[model samples]
Target: MAVTRTLEADVLRRQDPELADILLGELDRQSTTLQLNAAENFTSPAVLAALGSALANKYAEGYPGARYHGGCEIVDVAERLAVERAKALFGAEHANVQAHSGSSAVLAAYAALLRPGDTVLALGLPYGGHLTHGSPANFSGRWFDFVPYGVDAETGLIDYEQMRLLARTHRPKAIVCGSIAYPRHIDYAAFREAADEVGAYLIADAAHPIGLVAGKAAPNPVPYADVVCATTHKVLRGPRGGMVLCGAELAGQVDRAVFPFTQGGAQMHTIAAKAVAFGEAAAPEFGGYVRQVVANARVLAAALAAEGLAVTTGGTDTHLLTADPAPLGVDGRTARARLAAAGMVLDCCALPHADARGLRLGTAAVTTQGMGEEEMPRIASLMAGVLRDQVEGKQVREKVRELVTAFPPYPG
Candidate 1:
């Protein structure tokens, strides 16, 4: 679908001009800056429309047709559409779209499969593991016995041999395979084999790559993992929510876990928006969008490398990449601040095998803005100039504003 020129700001302003101004202010910020954040993207107006629809009023407390609350008939249809769309999109026998966020979906997966004291193996925090994987402060760590695994010290790749050894040594109840900053495609088949050897359940935390999977730009984990948990947003371009995919045998357990075990009422509005996004992703155009996202990311990673950043794994196969900027005379935290001052918005992530932070960025939002590989080198050059103190902050911000103005996310 074509991007729209206007939003429903008139109605919002009529009701509350104060809050409306805040909304427009955010729009201005987004329009004027570069969105290099890996975990962010622009949702189509159709998805946004569903989020602000009448479905928001509904408080559906359970699955479709089995709600705990009365008057859920209409919302039931919305949830059903979301579930079926997710199932079809991922080729999963069953899907639950009710989890409130990616972490909630992972919690449900653990609830459905493992006991409180069961041991689980996951990527370590320093190696790109999510907080839900095994952070000491998270519920996963407080409840389960989590064994951390690290990547290869030299290659920055998941040490499969080490993972297998850990799996066999610990005999964990579950093994998780995914990362927030690992830029390569995961070998789900290898993970499946490791899980099988130990009779452990394979849980794929595909929150970042699920969007690429939807567009067939990356491998899908649904076929190999016993359970797959992911967010509906990110490059999927849906509402901010979560989903779980599994085979039919685990459908009942997963659904029950998502509802009564982990969360209460489902967000019907977000479900409707996810349904819209899944439909969009199924279209042929979304495939092109995702492919371009990867292509642009590759260009950006290489250009950043040429500009003195130590690109992780040498480069990337997905939409996101992590790079060390020490050679540019700044660390990752300082580089992030400098980039922000130059109108480039991104995140600082953990650097595997190093104590210092690294910059993680992606091309998802820029691809949504219709940028291509041609623009990536320019972005890298500007970023390097800012980090090296070779250009004035005011001048860089002005150039960034000029570039984004030509490709407005919501062009008028």
Candidate 2:
């Protein structure tokens, strides 16, 4: 349990009736539901304990040995552990565990590599790119001159020729690779070559695939890119925080950017939790878990595709797959809401440069609950029934609830 448990109101107000009620409500929800969002996962209970520990009380203002404040001995140890574990997990020359989120990590990387108003080449927002990549409304776009790229019209894959053309034409200072929606494996070697041709830095945002990369199931870009940024919460199964890993040449700049430019005092408790998570990822069983994540995603995608739904990108090679529910005359929002009511959860996400009819589904959360191929068929069947609005959906939801109860996610 966390050392900060005493700080919770429950410990102080044992006589209050509302405390147990709220806890039981949340517990009941997790005890009888499924979570399928691609960018979301269920952290281990121990990870949660670490995240809520007493380390949160610390006021460490800088990196391990160089802090602005005094009494940072424990915080220094935690932060150093987080950095060391992150470096080992990703095979990076250096790691910074201070960024509050993936967006902050991206900002820090850009700040380290490029001046304000410098040009950057990245995928367009409508084409699976994140807001931080260069959305006009975001600081990245507002601060820099962003040249966006898109996938081919016919094939749902990025246009390398177009990217090369953009890099040549724009002379960008950096090229950002990775996406929230694109499904195939990225050609980091091609990106590395393109960046080199333009004398631009290569920044890989592997927030969606860090778990796969850590398990060595997905292609790693640490050796090929100047910097890589990712969230520790998503596939890494840690706290809701971010990390920046880079080559030794850029290490000091990355650290300063993450520390003084993007955030204030770091969350030392989360850093310690991130250390624990990285330790878990380094274990041999983590590779097996990541492989199962991919296998379960493939089975889910194929099952949905067999039912006439449009599985995006032909198929997925990672932990996520996108499916269009429009064939059954339903939109993504409606499908997601109905699925939630049925005790299954998925997020509605617009397809890359397509209409808002597709749903982004992942297996990480459910797979963490010890589910396997057995849940895929039922999940696909329930999705089909929900989209079709058949009476069978009610029956399917009952069975789904039963299965979820059997495998109780996030058990306390």
Candidate 3:
């Protein structure tokens, strides 16, 4: 949405034009470039309005009807709306919308369940695991003994048998099922079975696809996981925040883990924004949008493979895909720079079983911008040409500007 089409910019511009200019500059940047980032999307005007509401001034530090701060009766309503909407949207028995980010949500899940030095099982970092899963530099690894599982080297798919074997061997306290770049529908049932066999708690770090789940485009993990952690943005198109969902049995544990433990005061503005997004997702149009998101990703992946980019897993079933750019005479990092220069933006990710990095891009943003299956091939061709140096940067950039302008994210 045109965020500045609201009131904050007017007052801020009058009081602090310096910071106001920065805001406008960032808006212009987003408007001009193709945001193919996997974990991003265009939030609706309603969500933006909630984010800039007076709730931003509040400091509610606990659950509804039990906040420690005074004057929280109003913001409590917002939090309750968020909690109820989230539970109804995902069919969870309980929901916690107070976690600050996806990482924060994961930390709280750990605090609620496993103890320090407990063994945990999760996807390996090189094979699409999130840092919170077990990165040595992060608290997850330092606090627990993380046993890593990996995907198949040839198929670029999760090795479920290996996961089961690892779970049985390690007998971990908890098992995490999610990824930053798998580009496929996760087998939550399989993960659940493995966890059950091991008597381990299953935590679904579903930050990427929870939006899809909300729209019924992806499988709901609520039934299969002991805890589900997700971000409110991305395909959900909500504010930048995190939420945790679980059964009634674990609700108190999850709630306490979020408040007075992993985090302090909840951002009422963000929670309000999340409620707006949840309401939007429940609408029928959002279902169509998510379906198109996957359709666009499929076409884009196929087109990239046709352009010799070696699309990971041969293609994708989600909004994102990873592809090796070595065939285009450049590495993923170099390709990213070249594409960024040409007004196409994305991230570089580790290719499964490969020493070289690969490009990871998504259709969530572009799909929200209204480009569909027809535009996917053109995007792939443009990216391939840029990496291969077959097109001038200026020409590619001008074309990108034209495409984005034609499908302006917000129509004034």
Candidate 4:
């Protein structure tokens, strides 16, 4: 959809002409291209409207009912609705909607459970895990002792046995589960059992698959873990924010940690936008969209594999997949650049046992743009062309325009 700005041109010209022109060009480019980034999506107009609502003016420092500032009655209602809807959608005893992003949500969870310098076990970054999961350069690793486990080099799957052994040896305060590029369903029950053996808290970072879980396409981690942290974007298709859900027993600690421990005044506008998104996800059509997202990923994976590209772990059971570019004789960065020239917009991702020979592709953004099975083959063709060295920027750009034009975007 084309974003029509209401800002007067003369006003923008006087204030910041160069910056305004660049931003407008970017908006126009996005409207004309296809997006395949796994962690990105297009928010509904309602969510965007709420994001720019009057709620942005408010400053409600504390929780609902116990505010540190005056004139928060309506803001309190907006926040409570967000909390109630999130809890209902995720089947959690409590929910905190003030986290600014997934990273903040992880910090809040850590604050509630483990002290600084405690031992934590999580997946390795080279094995499809997130930076906050324990990367040495990240705050989590600097503050806490981190132990990591990797996927099997042979099966390209999580090595549960190795994880179990590590848990026994490390005796970590928390065990984090979930991945950014993993292609299979997570076994939360197994993770729970492992955590129980070590008397450690099970933390499920379902930041990527929360929407699938909410749609019943994936298993629920809340039943198996002590705490769950997820982003409102991704499959949720909500505002860019984070949420923490836990049992009633841990509600107080979670709330305190999110507010005074991690952040100050909440972004009331973001919270209200999150509430709107949660409401949209609860609709019947949203589940159908998620189902289509999984289907589209599988179709795209099969097509790429057929064209001689390597699909990590054979195929995907979720909305995202990793296409190994080693078979095409290229690094992830090169492959990503080539595809971008063709108007395809996935990101470079790590491959199993390889440093960086894979590209991550997702169906969420395009699916939301109303592209379906009809366009998957064309996207695959574009990818195949890039792999075969037959497509360049000019050719890909034209083909991409044709492909995207076939599926008219919903009016913004």
The number of clashing residue pairs in model 1 is 0
Candidate 3 clashes between residue pairs 3 or more apart in a chain or in different chains: none
Model 4 per-residue lDDT tens digits across residues 1-412: 4444543244675699887787667766666788899999888878988998899999999999998999999999999999999889989999999999999999999999999899999998888989889877888878999899989998789999999999999999999999999989999999999999999999999998998887778888999989999999988999999999999999999999999989999999999999999998888888898999888888988888888888888999998999887777777899888888778888987787875668998998888878887678778888888877876777888888887766644463
Q: Which stretches of candidate 2 lie over 4 Å from their true place?
A: 1-20, 392-396
List model 2 lDDT by residue over 224-310, tens digit each.
889998999877788888889999989999988987887899888888889999999999999999999989999998999987788
Give lDDT for model 4. Answer: 0.88
lDDT of 1 by residue, 1-412 (tens): 1322244435777788788778778888888999999999988888989998999998888788888889998888888888899999999999999999999999999999998999999999899999999998999999999999988989999999999999999999999999899999999999999999999999999999999999999999999999999999889999899999999999999989998999999989999999999999999999999999999999999999999999999999999999999998899999999999999999999999999999999999999999999999999999999999999988999999998888888765
On TM-score, the candidate that comes out on top is 3
Q: List the residue pairs that clash in candidate 1.
A: none
Q: How much RMSD separates candidate 1 from the native structure?
A: 1.5
Give the C-alpha lDDT of model 3: 0.93
Return whichever of 2 and 3 wins on TM-score.
Answer: 3
lDDT of 1 at 251: 93
Among all windows of 10 consecutive residues in model 2, the one with the lowest summed lDDT is: 1-10
lDDT of each: 0.93, 0.85, 0.93, 0.88
Write model 3 residue lDDT over 1-412, tens digit each, in one string: 4465653548888899888889888888888899999999999888988998999999988888998899999998888998999999999999999988999999999999989999999999998999999999999999999999999988999999999999989999999999999999999999999999999999999999998998898999999999999999988999998999999999999999998988999999999999999999999999999999999999999999999998999999889999999988999999999999999989999899999999999999999999999998888888888999999999999999999988888767
Candidate 4's displacement at residue 160, Å, is: 1.1
